[model samples]
Target: MMNICIKTVLLIFLSQIPVCFSYAEFKTDCSVPQSLNTKMILFSVDEEYSLYSPEVIGLIEFHFKEKSFINNVIQSQYVFPGNYDYQVIDKDLAIISIKEVVGNLVSKYQILLVCISDIQGYFIYSLEHGERMPNVHRDTGLYILR
Candidate 1:
């Protein structure tokens, strides 16, 4: 009887090992994105693209030169995924920008892309609009998208 009790206890403990490991895996999978200085949580590409209107996507793709940049944006967690303003600078140039407010402070980030060419694009982040250039020297904070 004692042998059977020991075997049951061991089985229960072994079964819980996978559960613990799974929880750890889940936490890592949903982990936040990283920035150079500030803490920012950019949205997942799939979420951003899906949230964007079809027309907006077309407009962005139309002037965005770097196709890979779009893929990178979609795959990267560099900007918050939320409402944005799109503007057409030229026939083949466009910008997508967003503003995020934390407490009473607001920050802006923009993506400049070419519509018809395969040129490289840029991701810009700043505490104020037209106040500072986008670089790795800003104090960004935790970005959470649900």
Candidate 2:
């Protein structure tokens, strides 16, 4: 009888292992254009593609080109996703710059890809504050979608 009880207890404990592991996995979904990898959560962000004044997009690409990882992220090829309901600033409509001046260029447009992931988990993590791994041992590169 005691042997049977011990076997039953062990069986229950073993059965719970997978559940425990699943919780530890800490997986989440990466937004549009972003693909979750073992290292970074990469997704695209949208902005006006102006050749005359490329400052807006330049700034964003410049940062990533540096390839700096913290919390949990890495470097990769970036791309635009789709058209979005993006707007520049909290203002009116359409910004047509003559030369170098950034103000309200975005009026519900382009969708860019942004990919990011956790170095430790190899799973998609939430970009929010609490969604990060409990104890991130390494630097995770968390980039904002422009």
Candidate 3:
């Protein structure tokens, strides 16, 4: 009778061993990818400006071609009434200059390379003073900035 009891306990423990391993494996798989995405979001903010010009805000978007990652298209837009100018530094970098007229004071806000992408094609926001911003994902290889 003691032999039978010991066999039963051993069988139960052995059966649970696989369950524990499977649970641990599943947890690691899910956690690894989730943590990577979170880190990407946290590292995306490149700058934070406490005293930013309130006159004009710029909106920019980058569209990456499918399969041909080297070829990208850029589109720029402005929020509020202002004279804006932009220059593409490269495929993934740009400089935006905004001129706002407020009460005879012409304020020029230079937003340099507000966003950039990695070699693996991940988009990150370039913020001032390492400010944290909302996580933004690409839509069909298009990244939009506001």
Candidate 4:
């Protein structure tokens, strides 16, 4: 009975070893590329492209040219001008810090993008406090490389 109990305990402890190391920590800072021309479309929560009728919230485009960063956000038929800074955490992962300026209002966002391939990726955006949109929450979206 003593040996059986010890073996059972050991089995339980070993079963948890993989769970502790399976999660990958998100990279914070690294050398990121300065050239970007990517367009991504944001979908409302609970929707994906496979639904055949995903509800799109907005479309965003990022451009880095001539040492300048240019960003465009289109929502509700209005285009907002913006700029961003980015850091590459890995060869296929990046964090984009953006500030969108609209007349007298400014909104901030931090985006985490994981590139699955050259033409497609997944992303999530966190909206900073004091945004122009009152009921807005954190949104996730997909990247369509341009």
Off by over 4 Å in 3: 1-80, 114-143
Q: Give all candidates' CA lDDT scores.
A: 0.33, 0.26, 0.31, 0.57
| Candidate 2 residue-wise lDDT, 19-129, digit = tens | 223332453443332221222333222234333222222212221222222221123344222121222221111111111112433222122222232221111112211
RMSD of 2: 17.8
**How many collisions between residues are there in candidate 3?**
6
Residue 138 Cα positional deviation in candidate 1, in Å, after optimal superposition: 11
TM-scores for every candidate against the unseen true structure: 0.28, 0.18, 0.29, 0.57
> Which number leads on lDDT?
4
Q: State the displacement of the C-alpha of residue 23, model 2, in Å, after optimal TM-score superposition.
A: 11
In candidate 1, stretches whose alpha carbon ends up further than 4 angstroms from where it belongs are 1-79, 103-105, 115-146
* Steric clash pairs (candidate 3): 46-127, 47-127, 47-128, 47-129, 48-128, 48-129
Cα RMSD, each candidate: 16.7, 17.8, 16.0, 8.0
2 versus 3: better TM-score goes to: 3
The order by descending lDDT is 4, 1, 3, 2
lDDT of 3 by residue, 7-107 (tens): 56766677754222222333211111111111111112213333332212223332212211111112223222334455565444544444545455454
Q: Least accurate stretch of 10 residues (summed lDDT) in model 2?
A: 92-101
In model 1, which range of ten residues has the least summed lDDT?
54-63
